[model samples]
Target: MESTTALDPATALEPATALESATALEPATALESATAPESTRTTESSTRATVHRPAGPVAPTDAAAVALRPLAGRAVRLDPDGFLGRWQRRNATETLPHCVTNLERDGALDNLRHAARGERQRFSGKWFADSDVYKTLEAAAWWLGHADDGRLTELLDEVADVLAAAQREDGYLNSWFQLMDPEHRWMNLAVGHELYCAGHLLQAAVAAIRGGVGPRLVEVATRLADLLVDRFGGDGRLGICGHPEIETALVEFFRCTGNRAYLELAAGMVELRGRGWLAEHSVDTGLGGSSFGAAYYLDHMPVREAGAATGHAVRQLYLEAGVVDVAVETGDRSLLAASERIWEDLFATKTYLTGAHGSRHRDESIGDRYELPPDRAYAETCAAIASFQWNWRLLLATGRARYADELERVLYNAIAASTAVDGRHFFYSNPLQLRVDHDGTEEDAARRQAWYKCACCPPNLARLLASLDAYLASSGPDGIQLHLYSAATIATWIGDSPVELRVDTEYPWRGRIAVAVASTAAAGSWELALRVPGWCDRTPTVTVNDEPMDAEASDGYLRLRRAWREGDTVVLDLPMPARLVTPHPHLDAVRGSVAITRGPLVYCLEQVDLPDGVRLDDLRVDPAAAPIPVAIAGLLDVPVGVVAHGFVEPDGEQALYDTRERPPHARRPIDVLTIPYFRWANREPGAMRVWLPTA
Candidate 1:
């Protein structure tokens, strides 16, 4: 069977002239600078604020203003034997190196060399290929923060040196435009991706600065950022990138350097969007003359007026991340509220059962509410990563548990399902269901490939996994709040006093979480909050030092306050029962089907697990019987699987359409085995479905 066809990045481009009158909207007055002095600025929200800038990707100058503050990169360490620990180590050992090797092999780095040597005809890879190198470099920087690797260091130095040599005197650094289209700089904003590439470079530099490495790369990025500020900051050409990301990157750069200009530039850029520039020039700028109009670039409405997510899945999510960053830093309540409203609408209607987004493959864009189709889902891996990134920022800004819950859903399902067990192969688009005859050659094939022509998700995964620990926990005025469960050591400051703790758990498989207090600098009282996942049906049991504690949770967290403790322990037991989940009636795609879940993991049935002569389409789960837990090993060392009772019905007539008056389909009792959604496709490629029809 041939694969269902769809438009990919390569086919989306064509040669066309830029519209001279695209910038018709008069440049509006710039927003007042939101950045303040080097000293921390206390806000109306919180009085007890920490002076130090909170670490991780987001560092709001006013730390206490936000609901939760992430601990510094050096504060938390995952145990090597734990689940996320293995992922981080794998990224360091396999994925990181793979990205570096591919950049060299696939001509991303060589493009820079070509530009440096003034060679114009030999440019290679996509126009946005430079972003991949930046993302990979960021992964290296973050990994180097905790682990030392000679090979990664050498590669980083080599790349940084190439980038420095290739960069023009004015801090412009794109290899493609430099070598191929020098005269059209910033001419084709809709499809050029020049600013988009620069944004990734800035983010890589920010990571390097935060991780304490790559000073030369930092210098190069700073120079480039300075150029952007000079060109677009104030009373300059008023235009926004067709793709966002520079807004967030500039804000982070401002946080790192305390240069008010970058922050002002980011704020101005955010303000300048929705003014109909990209929409006016999209077709003229050679975007394949497609029908993806204003909404495709999110130029349909202003960010503040937009209520729901639209446009390309990755683009929408990336823009939202920058919006939130600008909102938090500038203390714009209206902007923040707009972001929250859009997020609420996105989760309520647009999101999929696997926490994936983007239903339309033609444009790689988010579809209408409840329009999710399992078989045709274009839940691009980059979109999943973008969703996680957006959710992480929302979590930090509002300290909302729902944001954390969304993060867990995407991470355990969509994001985790992206990479193969070997860490080399990856799925560009994650589909919940793969028809038995799914075309293996399609760009969105169900099976993982070593690399894609676009090849964005691999390095994106690397950077996320390498920096995963920072998203697990946060510190507030009183104590630490653990968002994601993992075996790790957390050391953070609480009002000038240091506190250390060790967490032990086998999460997503079991419910037992033991938190042991290792040391406390302050003998006074402080609080520790644990997130009670929204998926927990029964009341989670909690105990302190083996004593039952009846603590009522508020805002999805159980708070326990205590003082003067060493060797004291806290244990939380959340019941883990496999349950069948049903989709909303409005979701016609899988309305009659059900999905199985245990703890934080979603389970799916692969054809390889079916009995002989049983086709995946013929199986119907027995909704009355509960799914049973079974242990498995040797495949990525995953420990658990689900066994569900179902019936395998014989295929009906061969006709595409059948009458209801046909004879009843015969059924035989069958046991269907399901692995974690993330673990599927790691084995033999076969048909798989997360939503099983119920008998």
Candidate 2:
């Protein structure tokens, strides 16, 4: 259906209920990895029992603590392979390089040049700061080992060299620090991303180190963490990060290296957030709102409670990430529930037809209902990525299909369409409509420009595409449930045993998937759960190894308890058809209108698709008419396009409704393809709508 609309957890133990979704949480990752032979391990991918992979590492209460950084570092994690392909270098390189390089050409790099010479000012994007140094190096480090091309590694090293050159004697490094607060170094934990950025760098270093290369960045992060611990202790001057992302990041670091001091340091930061001791007094320096958003990103709530999704998108994502720690680690389902409740409300209210969000650029706050103004929508590329990551984690916690469903929506519609397929350009606001040059001024330009001078999107996408290793985790005490199916293989330790899985399928298009489980143990007690997309037929004939089976189905998963060897196959049919879907009657804009859709794909009519001056709500599809499916080039791929000339009923001969001059109406074909309501402006900035009247 055309209007087929798009699509977190925590610790404080706020309520008894958690969020509802498509997947259910499997038993916790209790399998110790010490029982396997040197060649194999107690992989979480055991075919012996049904199993699920939780989002990230499970540690609650102190999840927001600074320790999670190292912990995530040491552990091998997964991200859906096709899930984040939107950020791939091949997909986004063209647009992003121009954005970052602009600063190099402009005097913006002069600011970095000044920082190189001991000067700094209001900086927008992170470049060669102490915090970014480790991360940039770590990224380059990974490229050094994994990438086929050596040039990328060199560029990363060059950036790292610049960052290392800008460091201060006591180990404090922030471009803003050098210019604005050299004397105030390490004074404010809550506001200073000095530590938070450092945490990312630490993570990058760890990723690089574990990949079997890049030790320099690792040492740099360790030293920086040491300095942070020294400065933020009970006796030290600061306690929290003004931005909050660093605390969770740091804790991940601690988990990886087993550094107790970092763990204690991370706790102090988290505690400071709850106590509000870091912001002792608000700074009036234009960044207060951003800081408040930042604080929430830390999930400062000691007790989890449900509320609306408000504030800036990035900050809110940070908050949800922190709270997820509280939920999984502490076993406080309520804290997780609170996160889920808020997220559900947010999704229901704020999400756009394209699964894009971030409406207001002024405060970067979530905007009003039905308030998806095309030109001004501020759905940042990073925001879409954040939403997917958070939801993916929740999918791990609850094992809900809704999480995966929403994740799929964002990945395909919002995230995928953010940048051009070439990986070079980007649109900060991925509105349904596209205007030629609406991005004016620094603020407006931030939305319109192919890339911002800040230039975080390119590297972000680059890194994500390069190391897409961890998303497909499997095996549990029971059996296995597939959360995401992209053609990829994962090799890692699951439960004190080494297991491998090769997932083969052209999913979202076809339902049948064959999974190759490489483990010594015979698969048993494990119930294989596969998601049947809601947009597809509710019931499918699920067969295991060509035998029809009675499956346990709910939300979207078709479950089958089976016994298996290495090569196992599960198959089903996902019907793709054209249908008209109507919105809730209460939705005033689309009260009488219906949307066109095929399978999970939502279709709309652009001016390019339709020939005449046709209004969006003026046309409709006959419920009984089968839309002619056509293959047309879309923003991302060759999508299945539908063609219809007119409504089911015939037109009149310029006569009044009851004038007795009209003949019986005849059904007309919908020859005009409706563009998505959001894709209205591809041809010069104008108007586009998704709703159409009845045939």
Per-model TM-score versus the true fold: 0.91, 0.73
- Tell me each candidate's RMSD, in Å, in order: 11.7, 10.3
| Among all candidates shown, the one with the greatest TM-score | 1
lDDT of 2 by residue, 1-695 (tens): 35212110121112211112112112122112111122221222111111022112222223432111111111222222332322333432443344345545544444545666765565545433333333334445443443344554555555555555665666555676676666665554445566667766766755654444544445556666667777765635545555545655665555445455665665555445545555554443323334344334443444254366766676576556656654565566776777788688778878765566778777566666655554577777667766776776677667777877777677666666555544555555565443323345543442334545555544454444444333343344454556655554444333343444445554543444555553425433455567776666545666666777765467667777656556565665555556677665544544665667655556666544543544343456555555555544544343345554465343446454465756765555555665433233334433344445555
> What lDDT would each prediction earn against the true structure?
0.81, 0.51
- Best-fitting candidate, measured by lDDT? 1
Residue 87, model 1: lDDT of: 82
Candidate 2 regions with alpha-carbon error over 4 angstroms: 1-148, 186-196, 234-242, 261-279, 284-303, 330-334, 368-376, 434-448, 492-500, 516-527, 585-593, 596-600, 612-629, 632-636, 644-669, 674-695
Clashing pairs in 1: none
- What value does the lDDT take at residue 79 in candidate 1? 70
